[model samples]
Target: MEFLDLQLVHALKTDGRAPLRRIASVLGVSDQMVARRYARLRETAGLRVVGRLNPRPVGQTVWALRLQCVPSAALGLARALARREDTRWVKLAAGGTEVVCHLAVRGERERDALLMGRIPASRAVTSVTAHRLLRLFKGGPTGWDGIASVLTPEQRDALAPAYPPPDARAQPVRLTDLDHLLLTALARDGRTTHAALAAEARCHESTVRRRIAHLRGAGALFFVLDIDERSLGGPSATALWLSVRPARLAAAGAELARHPEVAYAAATTGRTNLLATVLCRDDEQLYDYLAERIGALPGVDTVETAPIVRTLKRTGSVARDHDPADGAPRR
Candidate 1:
């Protein structure tokens, strides 16, 4: 990707909803050039742009799982785990001895059962360790330095705006303890039936339905979408850290939140004041995103990124345990 390409990515990273004309003006290029480059990046590289939701807001729990496996079996084990619908991101690290996976789930018990019961049964997996994300200090794609320099004062003023319009508000509803339990259950399995949730939550089936409706109305529950990156030909995912002036935090975060490639963006406390995550198609796209898109945002002084070498766990779920049905342990 060219220097200008990085600028476009940064602009998109800040605001996926940014108009092409705005991007062109910022880069001192025509809208057609920007559009052409973006198209090429998407079509040739299989890069995708999507909005990511915060798991916690929707009652989904995130966790990281670390797996120890035989060196040769690591790839096979990762492949099998990745195929499961519950699995999100998987990483191979520690010289192939460790496999980390991010998982999303509903409640602590079910998540525990999955880890202790299901994964240990697999012959490929030798051991597993899980950690819940207590608080998200940072997440997202790296910023672009090249574009930061390219952005002129007027361009920055034009690009950086106040908050985008708020999303539609869902009406709130009262929830009982059973309601919380049911919501937690469905958070783990979006497709779970009312009967299943009722059984787990220890409530009547009709109560489960009512509580679900109330939770949905309150915007406390949401459907989980399982995306197949391989099917889309996208490469692995990465998280980025950005340090920006405190005075500019809101503007920077608001802009970063709009990028389609960015799945999560938030202001945080630390050396890197801002965090964002991005999904790409390959190394080329990742490079382009970091160099062009992320580097260009206003008020960003520096960007640091670490590729998720492995997802130990995500959304509070385990990777390996014995299969409850078969009584076979997952390796």
Candidate 2:
């Protein structure tokens, strides 16, 4: 990622729906260049740029779980957990000594069934620790900045022509009040039936179906995924930060993104400019991955890692209601 490319990513992160012309102007680049680079970034990075809804406003809860498992069984257990509709994120940590998974559920009963019942049944899991997210300080990786400087204008321009023109007619469908009500209901319980949602929203099932289809097409809704690491027999999960040459960032980041163990990867500001989060099933997995997978990438200068002790809050909701500075009531 060149420094200019990093700037482009930052512009998009600020607003995913920002127009190409606007992004180009902000980065002091031509619209065509911005269009091309963004398209390539999305394709090469496997990144989904879409509107993110506040989970709590829609009535959902997020939780984090830590599991201890035997090294050999780690992959299988992780794969099983990853298959669940309630699991969203899964990571292998500390050489397969731990596995971390994020889940969304409606009530205590469902949560218990997942944690105590299904997880315990996995032959690979030895133990499990679950934490309900109480609050969230921040989530999501930072946009590129350090890499923006390395990209040449022509190189950036080369990336622009790849993007297809935006289709104005294909914009996301508008939601009715009733649709909002139904979405709110389903957000709380992703497994809820259409009839149930319709009843709660005071609409017919057909209306619910059409509205849901519209929301799905617009990327407003998706299936929730859940996983149990204990069953998978993996070790711990860790977060990592890396610094790389601005010119080589795009190629490097794209390479890391392809690793199956990596959960999230993005370009960001700060000392360790390129932020990458990965999951390892065991110590060997982590070591091999770092020593081989990450180390082999071009332009990498330094790597720093920290194990996530716990998640106070996650994607589904805002934990704290007070203001950050004074702790005053949020109005």
Please report, in order, the local distance difference test score of every candidate based on alpha carbons: 0.59, 0.57
What's the CA error at residue 299 for candidate 2, in Å? 38
- Give lDDT tens digits, candidate 2, residues 1-331: 4555566654544444346786677567788897788666555432234323333434456666667888878655765666565665565665656667778786778888988898888878888866555333223322222222343566345333222322212344455787667655664544466788777877789988787666655544543311222112343556776788989877887787666667656565545556665667667888998999989989999997757532222233222234365452211
lDDT of 1 at 317: 33
lDDT, residue 21, model 1: 83
lDDT of 1 by residue, 1-331 (tens): 5667556555655544356787898878998998898777555433333323345645556666667888878766775666665666666666556676767686778687778887888777887766565444234222223222345567655765333311223333445677656645654544466788788877788987776555544445433222223323334667666888888877778777666567656565556677666777677988988888777777889986656544433332323434354453321
Model 2 spans > 4 angstroms off: 140-331
Per-model TM values vs. the true structure: 0.49, 0.48
lDDT of 1 at 269: 53
Worst 10 residues of 2 by lDDT: 224-233
